[model samples]
Target: MEIRWVEAFIAVAEELHFGRAATRLRLAQSPLSQTIRKLEKELGVRLFDRNTRSVALTPAGQAFLPHAHRVFEELELGRQSTRAAAGEVYGTVSIGFSGALNHLTLPPLTRAVRQRYPQVTLSLAVRVVTRDGIEQLEQGSLDIALVGLPIAPSSVRTRLIGREPLGAALPVDHPLSGESAVDLADLAEDGFITAPAESGSSLQESTLRACVKAGFQPRVVQEIADPYMILTLVSAGVGVALMPSNVAGIMPSASVFVPLRDEPTFMDHALAWRPDNPSPVLHAVLEVAEEVLPTPRT
Candidate 1:
C-alpha cells in the first residue's frame, strides 16, 4: 500500500532471496520477510512462492513488479518537476536591454548565462531604450534590464556596471576624422543626429549635457531611436552624433569614431530590476551578470 512497502516487495521480487534482498535494501532479513508478508496480506494475493531452499515470484508478483517500478519512476519525475518549478534548476528569465548595450554588455552577459546556467532559458527583449526597459521591469514584463543610469524610480534596484565615454560619430571623410580626438566645442556648428529626449534614453541626455558643457547647444538636425541608425546617418554626412565609445565596434563602415577632447564625460550604465520582484530565475541571471559584467566604482 505504501511506497516503502512496494519498494520492499520489488526488491524481494527482483532479488529472489530474502537475505540478498535485505542486503540490497540495507534492511535486516527478518524485516524484509515481514514487509513482504504484510504487502501480500494487504493485497490478499500471494506474491512470492517460498520455501527453505529457494524463493521465486508467483505470476501475481511478476505483474505487480512492473507497476511498482512505474510508481517509483513517476514519483522521481514528480520530484524533479517540483524542484524545477521551485526554481532549483530550470526556469525562464526575461531580460530587457537598450540598443546601446547590444555590442557592449549584452553579448558577454548572454554568453555567461548560456554557459553556466544551461537549464535556464534566457528571453531577451532587445533594442529597448533605458526608459522603456525600466517601464517593462516595473510592469513585470521584464525580469532584468541593462540600462544607462540616472534612473529616477525609487522602487527600482540598480547596480553600476561600468562607465563609457561618449565619442563623436562622424563621416569617414570629415576633416576632423583625422584627428586623434576632437573637442566638443569644435563640433558645435555641426548638426547632430541624436535620440529624442522623449525616448527616455540616458545616452541622449548625456550627449546633450556634454555639448552644453562644451559651451554650445549642439545643432539638432535629426532624431533617431536606434543607435545604429543614428550612426548610419552620421556616416552619410546628414549629421554628426555622440554615442558610447563601444558603439564604434558596430558602427557604419563609413563612420569614424573620435573621442572628445578636454571632456571628462561618461555615460554610466547599470542593471535594474524591481525591488519586490521574487523570481528565482532572475537571481540566477543576476549571478551570471555579476560574473560577466562586474560593477565598477563610480
Candidate 2:
C-alpha cells in the first residue's frame, strides 16, 4: 500500500536483478528483498520469480508496474496543486545518511519537511558510509549527507548537528559489562573491533584516539563497516568496541554498552553539502533541518 513498496516493485521489474536493483536504489540487497516481500504480502501476489540465476516479473508485476508509475504521477499532480496553493518550494532533495542519524534524527526531520513543503520529496539513502558520502556529495549525487565528523577534507560545507558520547561495547558475559560504567583504561587488555581504516571512518579514529588518551594503543582484531554487524561480532565475544552511546540498544541482549567513566570521548556529527550546488529545494530542506535539529554548540 505504501509508495515505497510500489517503487521497489518498479525497480525490480525494470532491473530484473535484486542485486542491481538494490544498487540502483542505494539499499542493501537483503532489505530490498524484504520490501518486495512486504509488497507481495500486501497485494497477495508474487511480483517476481527467480532461481539462483535470473529474475522475471510475474504477470501481476508486469500489470502493476504502469499503475505504479501512475500512482507517482497522480501524487505529483496532487503535490503540484498543493504547492501552488501554499507557494511551497517544489523539488526533490536526495540525501545520504548513515549510522545513529537513522535512529535519532531522520524521522522528525522528514516529518517536519513533509508538513512544511508538501511538494518537496526527501529521497533518503541508508547504509551510506562516511567515505562514500564524501565522494557522492562532491560528485553531486547527493544534495546533503548526515555523517560523522572529522572526515577527510573536501570543499563540501558542513554544520555541526550534534555531539555524541563514545562508550565501550562489550559482550554481556565480559567482566566489565556488569559495571554501571567502565573506565577506558580498564579495557586496555581486551582486543578491539573497529571500523575500516581506509574509509576515513570517524568511528575508527574515535576508537583509536579514545584508547590512546586512556594510555594504551588498542589491538584491533577486526575491521567492519556495518555497525550492526560490528555489534553482532561483539555479541559473539570477538572484542570490545568504542562506539557512539546512542548505538547501545542495537544488540543489547548479548552485548552490553558501558559508558566510558572518565572524561568520556565525544564524536561530532554534521550535515554536509557542496556550496556550489544550487538547489532551492535543498536549501529549503537545510533550513528546515536547522530549525528542527539546530546545531548543538559545544
Candidate 3:
C-alpha cells in the first residue's frame, strides 16, 4: 500500500481514536477514516473495529502496526543520510603544508575546522615545498596550501596567516651562537646553507635580501630543500642558515636558533588556493582560516 495509507493506519492504530489521530496528522476525520478503509480494502483485511463512541485495533491491525512503524523509521533515516551527504562541509579537504612553515598556522586552522565542521575530513600533505605546494593546488590535487610568502605566478589567492622574524641557525659550539641575536654583517664571512636558489624559495630570497641590505653578499656552500636537512648540516658545522623562528622546533640538538638583529627582516606565511576552484568544503576551510589567522591591518 502507499506510504500515506500506511501512515494513516499507524496513526489511527496508535491513537485508537479516529478524531484524535486525524488531529495528530493534521487531517480531517472523514479523509483519515477513508484512507484507513482504503488501506484495509487493499490488504483485504479489517484493520480496526469502531462504534459511534469508541475505536479499537482489530487483531490484523495490531499485527501490521510494528511493520508500519518500521517503514516510517527507515524513510526518516534515509532522509537524514541524504541531507548529510548533500551538506556543504561534508566532503574531504586535501591540505598541503610547506616544510616547517606548518608550525605557524596548520595546527590552529585544522583544529578550528574539526571543531566547527565535524563532517569534513582532513587529508594533509606535509613536507611539501612552497613552490610544489602551489603546483599541487593548481593541479587540483590539494584544496588548500600553507606556504611561505612571495608565491609566484599570481594566479593563486592567498591570505596572510603569520609573520615572524627570521632567525639564524648556527652550530651550538660556534662563537656566534653565544650572542643573544646575530647580525647579518657578522656572518658575512661565514658559509651559508640554504634551499635551492632555482626553486623560487621565499626563504632564500628573504635571506639574500637581508644580507644585501646589511652590506654584504653571503657565501653559499650548500643548497638543501628540507629544513631538517639544513638544520642537520648546521649542527655539523657545515654552514649557517637563515630560517623562520618557528623552525626552531625541528632544529637538531647540535644546532641553536638565534634571532636576527636586523629590522624588517621577517618571513611571511600565507594560505594559498586557486581562485577558480569550487569545492564547497574548501570554502568552509577558508572560513576557518580567516577565523584562526589574524586579520591584516589597514
Best by TM-score: 1
Question: Which residue pairs of candidate 1 clash?
Answer: none
Error of 1 at 294 (Å): 0.7
Question: Candidate 3 lDDT, tens digit per residue, 133-203?
Answer: 88888876888888877877667898887787888999999898989988778999999998888876778
TM-score of each: 0.70, 0.70, 0.68
Cα lDDT of candidate 3 equals 0.84
How many collisions per candidate? 0, 0, 0
Clashing pairs in 2: none
Q: Quantify all predictions' global Cα lDDT against the true fold.
A: 0.85, 0.84, 0.84
Report lDDT (Cα) of residue 100, candidate 2. 53
> Which regions in candidate 2 have their CA more than 4 angstroms from the true location?
1-86
